[model samples]
Target: MSMPPVKKIVTWLLVIFLLYAIFTSPSDAANIVGSAWDVIANGVANIGRFFDSLIARS
Candidate 1:
């Protein structure tokens, strides 16, 4: 049997993604924000560590 057309497959995937996001896992969206903040925090912390290492070298 032939597979569904690409447009139909994309639409169905989007529909499923939206349904899952809206109904079953709303907080999952918030984790994206949390992940961004975590990355920011780690970047700042790494910069601080690098500066501290420079001071130690001096």
Candidate 2:
């Protein structure tokens, strides 16, 4: 009912779900992580480009 308890419950649920996923379809989980990494890398690269442009202008 409280926020802290709710957060703990959600975190546990996610951990269980992830464990189930890893046991069932490990390749799928690996793919998901790979895709997530790619998205994060692209975001970082884009931010770097934005800063580079700012520096070039100044």
lDDT leader: 2
Q: Candidate 1: where is the Cα deviation over 4 Å?
A: 1-25
Tens digits of lDDT, candidate 1, 1-58: 7667997899899998878886776688678768999999999999999999999999
- lDDT by residue (1-58, candidate 2, tens digit) is 4579889999999999999999999999999999999999999999999999999999
Q: Pairing residues by index, what is the TM-score of model 1? A: 0.54
For candidate 1, which ten residues in a row score worst on lDDT? 21-30
Clash totals, every prediction: 0, 0
Output the lDDT of residue 27, model 2: 99
